[model samples]
Target: MTFTQNRLSSERLAQVSAGSRFSYNRTQQAIGIVHFGIGAFHRAHQAWYTDRAMDAGDRNWATCGVSLRSKNVADQLTPQDGLYTVAERSERGTHLCVVGAVQEVLVHPRDCNAIIERLSSPDTHIASFTVTEKGYCRSADGSLDPDRAGAGSIYDYLTRGLALRKERGLSGLTLLSCDNLADNGRQLERLLKAYCAENDAQLGEWIATNCTFPCTMVDRIVPATTDADRTDIMEILQVQDEAAVVTESFTQWVIEDKFAGPRPAWEQVGAEIVSDVAPYETAKLRMLNGAHSALAYLGLKAGYTFVHEAIGDPALRSLVEQLMREEAAPTVATADGQSLPSYAEALIARFANPALQHKLIQIGMDGSQKIPQRWLETLEANRTAGRQCPAIIAAMKAWFAHLRGDNGPVEDPMADRLTEIASRTSDAQCAVALFGEGGMMPRIWQVSEEKLQALFS
Candidate 1:
């Protein structure tokens, strides 16, 4: 494979075609949003939206991304001068667009002080996060874990930044969470307030009086970019972009219409700013994410490599459809004028997109962090309503089987603990050991031995 030595940068923009490059003047843009977890999802979703908003003449919302841990993203984007490609893939074809929404990428701790400065700046009105569920460092019950929420964590940085903002007499910032967590923005506020109260009461009080954390529902299927994706994108752009992200054509962002200060004209660029985001978020978390997780473990176990392949299989397709329509959808309170049936059908079609090679194992990673909201919430709801979710039960069993190495090595954060429990306990006892009294799950989420045995049977 011959490599494209010409890297994607601002200078190379002149060589690229008109429609593919950013129409807005990149040099004139100001960074108003500092985002955490600068991964493929963020680049493909939020940054892409911001890029579109810029194209529509909103110049101040360009993002300054911070990678909390690895500098891999920084290494990818820094050399490219924060320029990257977003390839929107679908059954039709791939549409490539160069996104210049990110002005800079910073790595935490090393660029810690700079990050805080960026966060505290008056220009930075929104501090957004896409740090996955585990990044919050919450315990099973969802409270902030003191050990994990210390220095170098997102909470610590925000507290320090907010403190500095207060000292500088700048207005409060909006803490926007774009993760899949239910009530993500509010959860962020609660966790941050807890952290601040424990460390600095004054800061906590100020945050309570000033800042706003609005719930948001972000949807996009951005698979991890493979070598083929990079090569394909490079072929299109005629310049190598290591930071290019390939995703499905469908994208949605529903944010609660609450902000501490001015924000981008995101609504103009297809973002939904509503009074309440609960119904939408719940539907998404339960139906889309729950089905994704189920498909991941189940598909991997069934020897399917990509989502399209698994979704193509009639049995797997039926299972996913049942999981979404019967088990997950019933738990969601439909938003005003929102059709759950249509949404579920659209999700099915999205999963079957042949152009996007979404890996099952990629979605299966961090199952411990994902399932509590994805599957467990739906399961708990059904259980409380005296309705059994057989599909969810099957998925749960599949997850357990996955943990036991039936689907190869587990990639969960609690891999050691989970694998230990799965190995030591019998099939009937596995559910009890994992979800029983004093188990990994919360006390309220206890499972019976009979249920496990029935599932096995």
Candidate 2:
């Protein structure tokens, strides 16, 4: 059966699944947060949390989801009145929930002006972003990369919206970054300020005085939706849900508790609000995300398709252990009540979950943007201390090979330059070229070319 508003009712909720939970009063929910990048992960993780918060009577926290790059998500969700299904698949069992936390959905190209107005409104106290790493438009030197960001960048939209808000004499909004990059909130704030400074210094001052960008660490294993997933969701719900998301049962959100205005009681729903999110941010990036990237490039090079398949390989598993225990763990400054070893074990279990087919290619995408925090920073630290990082180097080498079409096709902002170097240079020379004068790698990391070249050798 087709899932439509007419077919959906209080009685129809039972038809979806005996245990599925949903809200019938979605119409009463007000949009308080404007979330960028409403992709599968956002739907599964942040939206799921917001749904739980709304269930607990946090009505003003309903999200207005905006697609910055494409209209695919907006189109998929609009027909269903911003309703979607999220299935938590784990070893224990499968649990389904229909998330109604999104009060409205908008595509940037079509509703650009409307989006500005929505975000600038007094009711919207927070603007959360999950625009992946590349969305920030940072160049190699951690500055705003205008060439990559172009006109449709998030910076462009956000700065313009904030300028409009200032023009309207409105209060500042809290900017939350839920991307996997280390110190994500700080990164966004820097980029946003950089862009604003270049265009409007006055607005930059307003941002500095009024706004706050809170760092966040979000952890969840959410695979891209597949046909089989859709089929299963339809079977369970007795209707088609175009925007259905599948994810692991485990989820965590660590946020810096700094906001300019009123905000949701996200802490009430398993989200840890901290005074300084740096320690937690550093740990997750180095441990969880760092290991995930390692597995992706290494797994692809070893001819494994899924993360589960990759982690199952004894040699690969050993490499992952080495990455977490020897390399990543030493670099992380463990926060209070945090255990690096336990986190590593939990990550291994999460990666090895056969029920969730997390794709290596998905993890391997946007390597240029992902590597600085995930590997390069640690590599630079190790190099500075005269320490060798075989596992980290191996992952980076796999990434270079990935760029060379050795593992697979490249999906990166710097694909052209990386592929050019890979196509022209030999294995050993590839590292020198990437790390050499006028290369993208050097923009992010300041390392000796000789050491980098040795890693390739």
Candidate 3:
């Protein structure tokens, strides 16, 4: 029972009543280029850019979105016929975009051969990623993580991909990491090489010689899935999309122009291709993400449940703004050629958007994963250049205080992790003590620790 002369799956048949059936007029497929760690951000940012490029590139840029961790993506996307709607939840209103650029979905364990097959394609132009900071196998010192004891993701993915590529003789694919980590591409290459060296040296050299990893800085506030989003998306697009992604009205991607093969005109799709993404990336991390994490840890402590709520509260709002304007902006460059003062103002305005309802817990999750990429790297850079990092320090100290389960007027620790952290630390001093005990922090952290201790204590 189709409403519009279309062949539809039962789910889409029910959800999207009107649309034509597949006439085998398939859109363009790319040269086996696969993106690792496909998530909400990838769908909203990278895939959006790629889709626009593919449409303009005359179908020369199709993507096979690869999920190394979940069957959720496959289950949601496969049923929808690989189609979903992206909703830009904005201050003014909601904007909907139906994306058809992702031609296929492959789960790592289930579709190993398919992933390799995509990479081996000679025409495969670029393999991009936004796997978050933890996805890269960097250690405390910011080089590749050496120990593979717990079977780290960075090691596992590269280990399998390199071994498969060698067996299949697939050469010269670009690995572009769009996470917030500093020197992201170089670190990614090191991780891949580390995996190869441990298992096979020749493979390491092959990866070193053939594969190129490009660093990138991406910005966007894409919240987790919500039921209302599902309903609204269904109402507007009239589609039953389980893997649909929702994000804020804003988005930005700044990538270093270094790729192994043919790439997308990301610039055509409102992305920036720059000589060095460092300044831009650093600015975003400090201004946007650093501010974000600061809000998450501190705001949650201040008894505010959501990011918007915290921003609305006078005290928390002051804390967020002061850190950004007074402490953070002096140290970094702004995107769109905006002044630091203006950038902070915009960020405050964006953060305070009442409609977005971005959750603090979402930003707060996986601090072990986020800080090295988002916060500490910027702090290290500032310190190295003989620049001051007082704002970053205050944010860090505030974060540490948060870990200790104590805030002055509002003493609220996130309920879920309380038991585990309590077991780990008896008090705030002990909590602070854990930083040097073979943790993710290193010498630069040591340099900043004294300053942070003074602020919190």
lDDT of 2: 0.83
lDDT at 284 for candidate 3?
Answer: 81
The residue-by-residue lDDT of candidate 2 on 247-333, one tens digit each, is: 998999998988998888888989999988877787788778888999999999999999999999999899889988888788777
**How many pairs collide in each candidate, listed in order?**
0, 1, 3
Best-to-worst order by lDDT is 1, 2, 3
Assess every candidate by TM-score: 0.97, 0.95, 0.84
lDDT, each prediction? 0.89, 0.83, 0.67
The candidate maximizing TM-score is: 1
Task: Give the best candidate by lDDT.
Answer: 1
Among all windows of ten consecutive residues in candidate 1, which has the lowest summed lDDT? 441-450
Angstrom error at residue 388, model 1 = 1.1
Off by over 4 Å in 2: 1-18, 443-446
In model 1, residue pairs whose N, Cα or C atoms come closer than 3 Å (at least 3 residues apart or on different chains), thus clashing, are none
Q: What digit string (tens of lDDT, one per residue) describes model 3 on residues 1-457?
A: 3223332243444444333221122344644457887788888888877766665554567678888768888787776556666778766888776666677888867887777667656667577777776666556565666553124254565555655667776667778888877677877777777666667788677777777787788888888878877766666664455677888877888888887767777788788888788777777877788889888877877777778888888877787777677556666765566578777888888888766778887787656556665666666666677776555555565566565545422222223353345446544443355344454354445454455445445
Tens digit per residue, CA lDDT, model 1, 204-291: 9999889999999999999999999999988887889899999988999999999999999999989999999999999999999999
The lDDT of model 3 is 0.67
